[model samples]
Target: MSENVAPTASAPRSLHGWSTEFRATFTLAWPLVIAQVAQNALQASDVIMMGWLGPEALAAGALASSFLMPFFLFAAGVVGAVAPLTAQARGARDIKAIRRIVRQGFWAAILLAALLLPVVLQIRTVFSWIGQDPALAARAEEYIQIAVLMLFPALGVIVLRSFLSSFEATRVILVVTIGGVVVNAFGNYLLMFGNFGMPRLELRGAGIVIVLTNIFMLAAMLAYVLRHRRFRRFNVLIRFWKPDWPRFRELFHIGVPMGLTVLAEVGLFTAATMLMGRLGTDEVAAHAIALQCASLAFMVPLGLGVAATVRVGIAYGRQDREGVRKAGWTSFALGTGFMAVSALCFLLFGPAIVTIFLDPGVPENRHALALAASFLAIAGIFQLVDGAQVVAAHSLRGLSDTKIPMLMAIFGYWLVGLPIAYVMGFVFDWRGVGIWTGLACGLAFVAVLLVGRFAMRERLGLLDRIRL
Candidate 1:
């Protein structure tokens, strides 16, 4: 928590130097981007394969996934503290701290899984209560139940991923993720379609394949960490089962708020998805398609956010204020710029993009396809603020400032965003467009607040005190 005097002359002092930081940031961020895209591709494959089964299948998967992913993100967020913790430790040349953080991260993952398991199991009943279609709810329930089986391994992968990514060893992450995508796509093909002499399981088959893929990914990540020559010196696998209560508590302290922050943001989006359901199947399916496209575009910035956390955490650990500033801003620039380009793609080719998810020959889907294209256009407009806010939030995470930002997310998403969405969609009768408009408003508020907070921290010289 103590601040050292600013580096006298060692730091870059000009825009040229800032450009160097941006280049370095991009180098670190692009692999993470690829890894994130690949992970999303896994889900996209699920949606695509499920689409082949029909709209109900797609809706069922989307609905169940909306409920399940918040829990996943919460667990991952809690465990994600490991990345910043490990990165800072590395920067400080404290291998023991790195080992301790990773070890405790596993404990955190276990506790979170135990706590979330029951909640994960009850989604079917919850869906019924929410007035979703009985048949759709039943299918969603079956899928959710099977998907719950993957939660433990999925979390284990999150923890291990944080450890691996902090070391900037993202190549292995990408390779494994690519493999997972292939495995999932192939598995879905065999199971969902009743190929290879198997009975058609449809939705249930998709869930099963997801579970299998998660297990394989966890196993692969564990194997790489345990035996890889690069990771051997850290002894990450040694004493692999020992309990460390104090560090576990520290991780929990950092992680719970992180989880809630993620929950606040993801929950808002999930809530929007649910609300869209009330507008009818066409609206919900269209929302899902457009959201999927937006989510894919989102991965680029999400990767940059991860990069920001590592780069800023490392700088923070070394007490290099300038390095921290440069890292955060460079990541923000890269993230926003990329999203701007993505927004252009979405705006210019939304119909073409929407077609990728829909079977054109299916007359039932034409309305949904057209609606999804419109949603994509709205999604494009929001991309700028969305990218900025997420990157800013991650930058704050890298600074180990989690709580205040969590509150900001709650305020932005719930107080500001949701109300507007409700009034516009229901009160004013704007429907799906109004709902997305509210989302844009929420993201814009969050972006402004978070960016301002970072700027304030820099201007007020409060970074060190906040670290305390």
Candidate 2:
């Protein structure tokens, strides 16, 4: 828990000129970006193939994924504490501590997966209670049930990925994740459409493909971690099954708030999606397409954010406050700059972007395509703030400061944002666009608040006091 440690390694190249720092950060970020995009592509493939089934299937798949994602993402976030902890231990050259962190990460993943799987199974009742289209809801429920079979393996992969990323060993993640996408896509083609003598199971088929992909990715990561020489020094695989309650408690202390923070943000999006469903299935489908575009672009900043967590955590571990500041600001700049270009693309080619998922030849899809285009344009306006907030949040996580940020997220997304989305989408009947704009406003608020808090922490010397 000490933050008074001397640097175990030489001063990092990140402590140099701004350009030097930028290059170093970008080097660490791009592989993470590729891995994230490839992972997202697995779901994108689902959306694309599901689109071939019709808007009802598209809506059903998107809604089910949205509902399940809150739990999945929350668990991933909790396990993600491994990255910052590993960075910190590396900074202090605390090999034993690093091993403990990884072991606890596995424990945390198992505990969270066990707790969440039952909730995933109850998707049908929740869908019904919310008065969703019963037929589509039934299909969505089946998808959730089958898809969640992968949750434990998926969680295992997250912990391993976080552990590897702390060493800046991301190429393996990128390769395996891209491989998973290929596997997922091929499996979906075979199962979903009854291609090559397979049953045309549609949503259920997609779920099965995801389960298989997760298993593959998990096995690949575990094999690499267990056998790779770079990881060998930590002895992570030796005596890995031993339980250490104090280490588990320490990880949970940092993880639970991180999990809630993630859930808060995802819950905001899911709530908006559910609200959109009330307007009609077509409306939900349109929202899904626009969101898909936004989510694709978002992986860039999200990757940078994870990299920033490692950089900042290392700096904090070395007790280098200046290094932490540089890492945070440099990452924010990189993330926001990329998002600016993405925003421009969204604004200039909204219709083109949305059409990639919908066939213009179909008269029914034309309305959804048009509406999706409009939503994309609104999505463009908030890209910069959205990017900034994520980097800021991750930077704070690097310092193991979670509780306040968790509260800030709840306040921004739920207390401030969701009400506005409700009033605008329903009360004003601006529908999907209105709901998205409200979500944007919430993101903007969080961006400003988090950046300001980091600045204040620096000025007040609170950064000197942070511990893990």
Candidate 3:
């Protein structure tokens, strides 16, 4: 891509300016934060609904989610490469480059969907091979079969989201996502329980609602992009079918590892879920509830990381090293600072939080409830490392420094984390709590490496080619 010299005179610089930087980052980050929470709320609602059908249904939903989410997140991560790339282009004032990046992003999302959706569709077979309960696998398969259709629409939304996020026009994303959650809740109510004479579809109804909600979100996003005056000039869809292989290859060049980085961490969790499945139904069910709570807490830092990608990306494009430094550290502070509060909440309120997913009044729910509360207490410690690692990884992504971070994820999650989990949970007989603590240790390791890597960006040559 080509760069045009753009001034960053108005941006905050000195230590005194850190307050201004913090304000600006928070201003951009809040909307993105709410949008992330809204999206997670969509899944959390499904988990809550699944709980209504009892522990078996909830465990099955957990298994189905454990299988499908890593695939979806991997695809979304690939599409997310568009954010930093587009932000850099925008900072350089390369309008043509911005258009091409968004176009190829759409291309990448479509192609990835075609390739990955089929893998998720075989959830039952995969679960069976992995020694999951055949009965649970059958139930989970029904949900996967219907919900898997949303894969394309969901990936498409990420492309549009990246396009919108680069310009900081993220209010629409938050608004639309909250709207989608409302629609999903209503759909779950009507479809799941046979309300208003509808057939009681149970898990299938949750899957059906998820598909419709995603389709609705995609359609709504497309409409806003098409209708909005700010975006019309770019003509993101002007020539949708034309091949831009160079940009496409560049997309994968940057995106594939980004996708796998997501896969590595989430795959660790997925593997952990499989291990939980081997323990018993109560373990799996409790893991699902506690995991859902942890995921929801994660949205804030995840959103802040997205903002950091944009801010740092723009600075990189402008060849402003000091700006990059400020952006990275400001975001890092915000992410970890917030998580400290979250960790306290998780520690203080584990039992209360667990009850939101399943009824504590029910006799069968008590054992899982106790286990989930203990697991959640460990997540209190886990939250801090989780926030730090995510923000650090995303900050590196802003530098277009991907491959090493992916390697770091592999090292932390598989080599260090999962092994510890296996030894602690199986060998030590610590079961669920041991598995979670091991995962937290893995996150802590990656957090140290990634943040250290980012801190050494200059020495590492992670800065862009442009000479200031």
Candidate 4:
């Protein structure tokens, strides 16, 4: 392991009125934001297209997505470990370490994909237990089954994407993700409604579109990585081989807990959707719209989090403790500010926003819209905290302190968040707003705890341990 590097022996510089460090951080963050936006657009398009199939189809898509999201938690968290490790390697100028981290990430991705297969196969049973409508459950199960089969290729894409992100080569993600979005939209149009002589598979067709687009994205990303001279020089894509047990262990040490943390958080929302179903079809549809909106709004902060991981990892590698601190704070400030503006928009014009996904002319839809707007209003208050937590968690990941954050998220979301939501949504009959309020509380706790952890780590000179 490369550790203990001296900082550059030079004076700090300024960029316009901003510090050079801040400017560099922003430079890294923008591509990530754009990439995230494009990805969100693809997902939103899916929801929008399915909405045209009527409320039941839309609800089925939501159910399918919620069921499948936890699988991504595993893929995402495992692949996510690569960035910090690679960033540290890059900071140390250790090409060998970088290669090792990248290879190990690929191994983890494959293992995770294999592990998820059984779970995906059991998705039908899981949905039944969650109390989905029999008809909706069948549709959701079909979509999820096909989508799950695509996880193998998707895992490869995520690993490669993580490697590029660690090097701050975020533009690669932007290009491929935007391309995927365009492809997904066209595929959805042709398949979902059977346009241009295509068979109309409806919900199942949408799922197929998602799977095909993901495969195309993986191919595009791999082609770019293989053909690009700069990437070729990194030697990340040599011969494929078996897992290196030691390296795999190290990755698993960090990844499994991180994956569980993500699962816990995502699972809470998935469970919320299940709970919403018990209330009625309209309620579930409304919740789906709200969930989609929240997920879209979250992309800004999510991008910032990815950027923070790279910045912090590089700073840690350089043993620049202060630089790590600055990067984390800058990311938090940028992410929170951007999301806050979005929150205000959601609060002030939530009805209009809901109209984008639901038809107000339908009585059921009108009720759903009202409930969705209410949920959005509560969710708005927590957006800043949500952004803060994600960025802070990413910063900590850069420092290789993934475990504590994982514990915090699990306890905060499950022990605190879910129970509160359950009481409010079910026991107290506070309905949707109650569940959202519970979510806010969970997110708030996570934000406070993560920020505190980051600050403590910085104060203790944790970043100095890694040498670049």
TM-score of each: 0.88, 0.88, 0.88, 0.87
Worst 10 residues of 3 by lDDT: 1-10
- Summarize candidate 1's per-residue lDDT along 108-163 as a digit string, tens digits: 87788888889888987898887889999889988988888788889889988888
lDDT of each: 0.86, 0.86, 0.88, 0.81
**Total backbone collisions for each predicted model:** 0, 0, 0, 4
Give one digit per residue, the lDDT tens place, for model 3 in 1-468: 112224345432333367877987898889999998888788889989889988999999888987788888888989999998998888778888888999999899888888988888888889888898999999999999998888888998999998888888889999999999999999999998899999999999999999999989989998998899998788888888888888888888888889999989878998899899989999999998888888888989999999999888887776666778888999999999999999999899999989997899999999999999999999999898899999998888888888899999999899999999999999999999889988998999999999999988877778646463
Poorest 10 consecutive residues of model 2 by lDDT? 1-10
Question: Clashing pairs in model 3?
Answer: none
The Cα error of candidate 1 at residue 109, in Å, is 1.1
- Write the residue-wise lDDT of candidate 4 on 1-468 in tens digits: 122224444312111222766787787878888898887788889989989999988988888886787777677787778888888778768887777778888877777889888888787788788676889888888788777867777878888888888877788889999999999999999999999999998887887888899899888888887788878777776755845677678777877777787888888787787778788877787788888788888988888898899988886776565567677888888889988998898889888898998888877677888988888887778888988899999988888888879999999998888889889988999887778888989999999999888877735555446333
Top lDDT prediction, candidate number: 3
Clash-forming residue pairs, model 1: none
Summed over model 1, clashes come to 0
The superposed Cα distance between candidate 3 and the true structure at residue 179, in angstroms, equals 1.2
Question: lDDT of candidate 4 vs native?
Answer: 0.81
